[model samples]
Target: MKILITGGAGFLGLHLAKYFSEHFVGNKDFCSLLDIAEFDKKEYPKNCHFIKADIRNSTLMYQYIKSMDYVIHAAAALPLWKEKDIFDINVGGTKNILEASFKNKVKRVIYVSSTAVYGVPKKHPIYENDRRVGVGSYGQSKIEAENLCFSYIKKGLNVTIIRPKTFLGTHRLGVFEILFDWIHDGKKIPVVGSGNNRYQLLDVDDLVEAIYLFVVRSGHPQGVQRQQGHPKGDLIYNGAFNIGAEKFTTVKKDLEKVFIYASSERSESRSHNKNSSRQARTISKVFPTPAFFVKKALWLFEKLKLSPLYQWVYDTADKDSFVSVKRLTETLN
Candidate 1:
C-alpha cells in the first residue's frame, strides 16, 4: 500500500510520517512525502520517498497522487502567512489535492483540518453539527477547504476530515516556541486574560493515532460497511470529526505545571554541581493581562509585522474553546 503525505516537512506531517512508517512495515507499503520545502532525510524513515513540490501546482499534485492507496492532505499556509497566501494554499491547494486524489481514485484521503473553523464560539464543547463561523484568514480558509471536501465526498471521493485542536509534540515551534523560550529565560509569560480558561490541547502522537484509526478502519473499497443510523452508502469515517485532549485543566494551571517542571529540572542539574551555589534560580510565572488591551496591542503588532500572534489566537485565548469528541470516540468504537 503506497501513501502520499502532503506538507511532508511540516510539524504534523513529520509526526504522521514517523507514525505511519512504524505501522507500514510491509515490503510494498511505503510513504511518499510531498512538500514545497526540502526534507531532512535524516528525520524520515528509509521506507519513505521525498518529493519537494508545491501543492498549489495542480499538475505536480496530479502526477504525485497517482496510484496512491491513501493521501493525507496535511499541507496548508499557517496563520502567520499573508492572507492571500493562506487562501491560495489552504483553499485552492486543497482543491488541487482533492481533484488529483479523486481522479486517481485513492482509497482514502485524510484531511488534517483545524478547530479554528468553529472560531470563538460562546458555546462550550462544540459539536460536529455546530455552526461554523471562521475568525481569520486561516480559519476561513479551513472552512472553505472543508466545504471542498464535503463536495468531493458527495461526488464519491472517500474523505475524512479531522478537526484537531492546537496539538503539540516534539519540535513543535510557532507560538509554543515563544512560550518555551520565555520559560527557559525565566521571563514572565503573559496570558491575554485571567489564565483560568480551559484551553484544551492534544498531543501530536494521540492525533496521529486517531488519524490512523480512520485510515485503516474506514472508507475501504472492499470492506465498506455503513453505520446503523448513517445513510446507505456513507461510510463511518468519511466525515468530519473533532478531536482533542481528553484531559486538561485551566490555562494558568497547565502553564504553571510546565514552569514547575522546568524549575525542578534546573534545580536537579544545579544540585549535581559541587561548585555551583545553592541559591534558587528565578522561575517563570504566568502574568495575566487585560484581554481587551492585549487584543488591541496584538492587532496593532500584527498590522506592523511585530508579532506572530494572530486574531484567532488572541480572540479565543481567554474563552472556553473545546470541542465534543463524542462523535469521534463513538464512531471509532
Candidate 2:
C-alpha cells in the first residue's frame, strides 16, 4: 500500500519510515514521508520518498495526499510549549489532514496522539475508554486533535487514534536524554526531593508494532461517515507499555547509581572516601544520578534567589527529570 508519514524527520517519524520501508515490500508500494526537513539521500532508504512541506499548508498537503493508500499522522506540538503554537498546528493541521484524506479517498489514517490527551493519568490503567481531560495547553491541544479525528470519523473518514505514553527509542529519545548526556559529560545528576515519582514509557519499536496492527485492520478506506451511531471505521487505542529496565524508578537513588557507574569508571573512587555506603557503593540500577539531584537543587536555588550554586545546579539539572512506566502494560495490551 502507498503510505505517507507526516513530521517524518522527527525521531518517531524516522523510525516509522524505516519500519515501513524494510517490512512492506509487496508491489514495493511507495513508503513516503512529508515534512519540512530534507532527507539525506545518501543515508536514507533510496526507494522511500520524502516530501518537504509544513502540515498546515492545506492546499499543498491536500493535493499531495491524494495518491496514497494510507497516512500515519505523527505531526504535533508537545505539552511543554506555548498554547497558541500547539493549537495552530495540532488542531488546525489535523483538520487539514482529514480534509485531504477525504478528498483523496485514502484508505486509513493513523493518528499518533499522546497520553497528554488525557492530561495526567487518574487511574492506574487508563484504558481507551477513559475520559480525556487535559491540564495545560499541550494536553488541551492533543484533546483538540483527537476531537478532530472523531469529527472526521463522523464525516466518514477512516481514522484510528493511539494515545501513547512516554515512548522512547530514537530521535526524540524520550526525556531521559538529559540524564544520559549528563552522566556521559561527567556532571552530577539532579534528583527531586527523594526522586520517587514514577512514569510509564513505551518503546517506539513496540508502538510501531501497535500502529501496524490498527492501520492494516479490515475497515473502510475513505474514513468513517458522519451522523454515525458509533464511529463505523475507526479504532481508538491508549498507547501505554512498559519497556524500561524496571516498571518504576526513583530520582535521588537512581541518580546516585548513575553517578557511581559513571564516576567509578575512573578507578579513583576505590581510593576516595569509602566509609558511607550511599556515598562509595556503586549504584546498580537504572535511574537518575547525583547530577539529577544537583540539578533540582540548582532549580530550587534559582527559585529561592540563591547565587552561584543556582547557576551550577541549573547547568547540571537541565536534564534531570523522570517518570514512572509501570502503568503502560495495562493500557497498551
Candidate 3:
C-alpha cells in the first residue's frame, strides 16, 4: 500500500522512514517522504521516494495525499524556535493535510500528537481524558491541531492519535546532546531541580513498534474498552492512545546512567596506556540548577536566540509528567 510521511527528515520521522524502508523496501510505491528540507539519499532505502514540499501548501498536500493508503502527520514546529508563531505549520498545516486526506479518501492517518497538550498534570499516570491545559504556545498549537483530527474523525475519517512523551534513542541530538557532551567530557551533569520527580521516556524503537501495532492490529478484545466517556453498550475503541513506557526513572539517576556509560568507554580506551589508572572516574555529585534559575536562563536564552532547550523543556522539567499506558497495552494485546 502507498504511504506518505510528512516531516520525514525529522528525528521521529527519520526513524519511521527507516523502519518502513527496511520493512517494505523494493516496493517503489510503498512509501514517500515529504519535507521542506532536502534529505541525504544515502540515508534512505533504495526504493522510497523523497518529496521536498511543505505541508502548509494545500495544493501540494492534495497532490501527494491523493490515492494514498496511509498518511502519517508527523510534521510540527518543535519548541526550539525563539518565537511561538507555529500555528501556520502546526495547526494550519494539519488542517490542510486532513482536508486533503478527507477529499482523497485516505484509508488511515496516524496523527502524532504530543504529551505537551496535557501541560503540568496534577496527578501521576495521566490518562487520555486528563486535563488538556497547554503550557506554552507549542502546546497550545498541538491542542488545536489535535482538535482538527477529531473533527475529521467525526466526518468519518479513520484517524489514530498517538501522544508520546520525550522519546529518546540514537537519532536524538537536540537537547540530549547537552547531556551526552557533558558526560563524555567528564563534566558535572546538571539537574534542573532536586531531581526527585520521575520522567517517562520511551525509546524510539519501542515507539515505532507501538505505531506498527496500531496500523496492523484490528478490533479490541472483549471487555477491553477502558475509556472514561461514551454511551453505554458502545464498544468502539477511540483511535486515541497515550504512548509511554511503563517504567520511569528520576532525572538524576538517568543522568548518572549516561555518566557511567561514558566513563566506561573512556576507561576502555585508556586501558592500553600503562600510566592509566585502574579506577573508573565516577561523578559522585551533580550540579543542581534550581528550577527558577533555569527558567530565568531559558528566558534570556530565548531572547538571545542561543538556547536549544527553550521554553518547552523548562516548563516541564521540574514537574511530574507521565501518562498511563495501560490502555495502549491492552489494545495491543
For each candidate, C-alpha RMSD in Å?
A: 2.5, 8.3, 4.3
Query: How does residue 63 of candidate 2 score in lDDT?
Result: 81
Best by lDDT: 1
Per-prediction backbone clash count: 0, 32, 0
Best by TM-score: 1
lDDT by residue for model 1 over 25-137, one digit each (tens)? Answer: 76453788989988888988888888999989999888999978889999999898989999999999999999999999988899999999998899889998898999889
State the displacement of the C-alpha of residue 332, model 3, in Å, after optimal TM-score superposition: 1.4
Q: Which regions of candidate 1 deviate over 4 angstroms?
A: 219-234, 274-280
Q: Lowest-lDDT window of 10 residues in candidate 1?
A: 220-229
Give the alpha-carbon lDDT of every model: 0.87, 0.63, 0.78
How far out, in Å, is residue 190 in model 3? 1.2
lDDT of 1 at 55: 89
lDDT of 3 by residue, 1-333 (tens): 788889888887788878877776577758888999778767777777889999889999999999787888898887754234488899999999999999998877888999888887779889988889876778888899989988898998878888998888885577787767667667776678887788888899888877765654422223224333446222233457899878878887777777777777877777767576544465434678889988898889876878766566777788786899988887666
**For candidate 2, what is the TM-score?**
0.69
lDDT rank, highest first? 1, 3, 2
